[model samples]
Target chain A: MSNPESFRELCRKEIHTGPTSGVLPGYIQANLLILPKCVAESFEDLCTRNPVACPILSKTEGRPQFLRNHASLIKQGTFDIRTDFPRYNVYSRGKLVQQKNNCVNEWSSDHVGFLIGCSFTFEHALEKAGLVPKNVLYNKNVSMFRTTKFLDSAGIFHQCPYVVSMRPYKLTEVEIVREITRKFKKTHGEPLDWGYDGAKRLGI
Target chain B: MSNPESFRELCRKEIHTGPTSGVLPGYIQANLLILPKCVAESFEDLCTRNPVACPILSKTEGRPQFLRNHASLIKQGTFDIRTDFPRYNVYSRGKLVQQKNNCVNEWSSDHVGFLIGCSFTFEHALEKAGLVPKNVLYNKNVSMFRTTKFLDSAGIFHQCPYVVSMRPYKLTEVEIVREITRKFKKTHGEPLDWGYDGAKRLGI
Candidate 1:
């Protein structure tokens, strides 16, 4: 059970009870968004448009208990969208309504799930390169701000404010950070804004 | 105005009416599929699963005149899902009903468009790498075969045979070809199989 796959098995068995972060280092972890099949495409469009905030790793419909969705990528198994994770926040009608350790009852046959990427993946690369971000140095959560920027609306999805994640680096280190992170486009590649002038550009 | 963008401008105005191949050598060309919003997610899932046959570059809904999606990528303008392409084959009720240079009348606000990648993009990469495909050497169309393999079915998109496009190379050259093309994952990313055994494996 030392490997991430075995760790996922523990998660499936409800034995490993904690957040998935840092458990699966060097492997891409995902932020999950499950929705009814009816609005799946529209929300996918929103995520595609706002990739920095919602870079999609994989998406599928009706396949419960699975994440990476190609038939080639997955074996017949349990990814139970409901029980695979340690915990879940249930949203209804665009609002967070409840929290649960297991969401098996919340899932339906027509549900679609998106596995999105975040800064977590590339932050490892940053750490390996010795460009530890100020957030980590200070032991603080990455600063996140909702920019006035909005994603283009898709069907039934409108006015999505593009959220930005901020981690400060020395101005001298910005170029190297960009060089390291841009290669991982799936994980929000390169900062959207940085330094004083870059901050001004995003109007942060 | 000699670049691909200007070429697309010509396409938008209907001044260019020919197959969009080799015109923009360094730029990515796409195969377009548009469907009503109702079944878009199902089809997208199918494509995502069968990426070698249908590598998606971008997809969008509602923005009728676009190809590369995302609010960041597009300005309000005309790629005219219909008029931007040099030609189109219109399918109706599961049959190819008509071929036209202009499909404007066929589009509606509810339509979703997917821009899929093909061997076209990486073929350029191969040519640049000095490993001209046998198809190009013989000046013939790339050989395409419908394998018994089927794409993982999605809603309303079922029983789809996974198509394979074959372009031969010397056995010794296969690895180099693979190395060159694999980086371009958007464009099918390397050969599915290679050499005589590879051919036999496909039962072609």
Candidate 2:
């Protein structure tokens, strides 16, 4: 993978459409959600109420363009959101309709976009602490489960079950994992649980 | 000054339009902004770029009803946004148009609202520390100055001067004030600078 900027450029041109794993090693990658203005408020509320599941990276109201440069770049209108991401999961009225390479055709004047913090950021920190994240070792996407734990409902997003990504670790390492991830409050801070009974508590 | 719920009820009934100072003591009060979905993204970007000037408490996509309870309430479709605020400053194309006790008429389906952290939260900490915030001492609104500091431009909010609310303190108490305020990162965190030269440096 090239530098983040060049990687984004390639994505902008539709040359890359796969998972962004191991790309831009030290830089952050985010989960994307775009919705109509009518439902944007509910989504924002959902993120706020469930900070651990939906830690926000950045959000845009109705603009289709995004900033490619780091937060320090003062100038406006840097990147086009329509074609920048590797892939987008498109939903309509709370149903997954399709996954698209780019959302250019789906973009609308009333659409709002959110960049949510992915757990991948803290996974890097775990590796540095001499702890191997299970997913990385397995060479698979992180295991995600829909838990019976209900998210605090926001406007249109009522009573939705909380979704959590899972990674297994030895019982002895649980405290250390919690300590390291807790420091990143913005990136789904800390593990929800560690062992088999822990998973049972979440109803996974 | 009553419990936050009752105070909100009074505001909803159009009885309380005064400054929220000393009302619902120990409960948080917020700075409110309501904008059409058109400018919402720019404002979100503006907040992201200049977090110190605008630490957001909660934002809604297009829902007019704010949470009557604190952020913990999850059930949807709660308070109405129109008559809930003690006051609202209306803006058209980035210009202040009117300050209204209620914005029921001005709010459209296309509008989004933001609850931003007010410096008042830290003022309590200041008072507890034996350092009286200048505004509270003078029995006036906090002194706000437009600085030469430029906020990073977002979509429609371009090259806007950063606005800071000020409270003067003795040189000896500067570090103490900073230490106390730094804990409230969600609110405007700490003094950007202290002393007469500090104000001059910000081009206030």
Candidate 3:
């Protein structure tokens, strides 16, 4: 097992370049949101209204500092918002602007970063329950689909579609899966729906 | 009870100009954070790491749109972030820059806003449990103290002090207060500590 601190050091050194899935088994993983201050309020509203899709874990204060002693893995080190991530999907005016390894030059005094809880937190519980998450089994990213369900609008995020990441399981495993995932409230707790009908209900 | 939507309408029209404390009983009220995009990521990280002190309710989506049908009070209407609040405290480089009733001219697309949950959500529960929050009893804003406890740093927000809003309660009521407040996880959740020693432990 990689020492979480060492893993972070590698990320900081630009040596690790890949998805963070299953990297550090027990530690929590997060999705990231970086945006300008001008539209951050609306994004906050969206996360508030849509907790399932946007379970926020933490955010930075208005100034930059090295994160120290929040979670066990994020211990006593500074991470560059620009170059730390393996990849970043940049958005501009609600459109995918570009993909980059670092955004150091783009960062400024007015930017904000949000670390949202990803579905990975609960996958451990699912594995513990003896139900393997499909993505882990297949070595593929989880399937995500946009839904017809309208997310609550806040500021600039108006009536946007809710997105769902899917993992397949047998009919027999539904009960155990729900029961296990429900405990992870800070993550995307509980499945919204299941089966082929589930996709249809979401109007995928 | 006042119609929540109407109350918001007045605020939108610049007709209501006062603290929203106890305005709409039983409904949630939030503290507002509006900052330039340059520093928003750091602020977001701060909120995420220190949820107890800075429980975030929602954020803007980085665009301007009328918030429609999220919460009952925030029904179909456009809110001018720059002019809607009774007042706004402007911060520059982490310093209190200015306070304004309207920031219309200063607002730009590069700014983001955050609506953080205030302690009011649990106050009603406290009242119902026969333990009145001191702020409510005294008709004052809750007493807030800055603690020596350092908040977990995210991005640019490093080594910031944790700020806590205090509500004094009788020693006999500590258990009940903790029980009642614990249910409101989206807000500031349960009491961190109780009594004078609580402040001392927090290094006030």
Candidate 4:
């Protein structure tokens, strides 16, 4: 494993395990997608088609190296796909397999990397606005739901519902929430709709 | 009059005579507001209170000089307050008197310069996302209408209706438009309503 002091201390030994939020402050955080190069191009096209759902930050054409914007987050050559992330889920034919923290041995030559814009940037903006993120406050993952809304799909892009992340806010702050989400298109732009009904419809 | 060559040329010769759009492209463009210092604190408070309507970009606490953000566009310590703009309207006690180009000498030391966020940023983001900004292409100002919605007001804010800017697109882009608008709380975030009849009630 590539030896970066922080990585070695926190993740390499399997001690630090959680969603990679609040890990590196002030730097852009990202969502990861690993796919075969054959399917990567089509997926990228789909992202372009429905950018609100898939704001593309950066992508690796052939191998799953960190994209340029995310390069600063790489600790060392130690990006042991298997052990680097606190946790990862393996997928076969679009079906998720056993969850693992590291996948060095499973790493394949044909893998390509896609990094997407995350809510971190907008969340930072929100914090600056003094609207504390309740999920972060409560130390829980922002609730995510699968929506019946279909993202524009391309070749081999399954016509499946989109997965959305949501948070609750006061009725008075609905306008504020609407305003903040407009800025970060790379993140899902805004809620598909408001209220628990919207959540239930999305199968949250 | 900081004597930056480019800004100097634009200001001195009045070459920068336009709506001030796309100038100093990456620099933040501010919507200019000049209010008497006597009313400044209350107005500032109003901005603070109704952040969506008035995103406080930068303010001159007492006088309009040393104005923030768009300073790069000023020339030789001079910004042509009157002739530099494409158009201008004079309002006394919130009443319109004349529409002219510049209001240079008419400005008083008591006049405080307020720069709030404009719709340009969100429009740029929308265009970047392959969504269209029809108003720009039509070469007209984005439609500004009054809304029945009363913005939460402070001193001079007075619970007045809001002035909303609209850029029309196909009905299909409703979701995309909503999403894009949400990001721009510093500006007006989303449309008060998607359609016009409702927006027209306030004499927009």
lDDT of 1 at B154: 40
Q: What TM-score results for chain B when candidate 4 is compared with the true chain B?
A: 0.76
Off by over 4 Å in 2: A67-78, B1-204
TM-score of chain A of each: 0.86, 0.90, 0.89, 0.80
DockQ of every model listed?
0.02, 0.02, 0.02, 0.03
Interface RMSD of each: 17.5, 15.9, 14.3, 13.8
- Local lDDT at B24 for model 3: 75
Total residue pair clashes for candidate 4: 17
lDDT of 3 by residue, B1-204 (tens): 376656756766668766765667788878887777988876875676556667777777665433323434443354555666777777776688887776777778897878888887778767877787778887777788887555534445655766788887779877777667766667876666567765676667
* Candidates' RMSD to native: 21.5, 22.1, 22.6, 11.1
What's the TM-score of candidate 1 when only chain A is evaluated? 0.86
Model 1: chain B TM-score relative to the native chain B = 0.87
Candidate 2 colliding pairs: A40-B61, A41-B60, A41-B61, A61-B41
lDDT of 2: 0.72
Top model by DockQ, which number? Answer: 4
Q: What C-alpha lDDT, on a 0 to 100 scale, does residue A201 get in candidate 4?
A: 46
lDDT of 1 by residue, B102-160 (tens): 77888788889888886777777788889877776655667888754444334456556
Model 3 residue B116 lDDT score: 86
Scored against the true structure, residue A40 in model 2 reaches a CA lDDT of 84
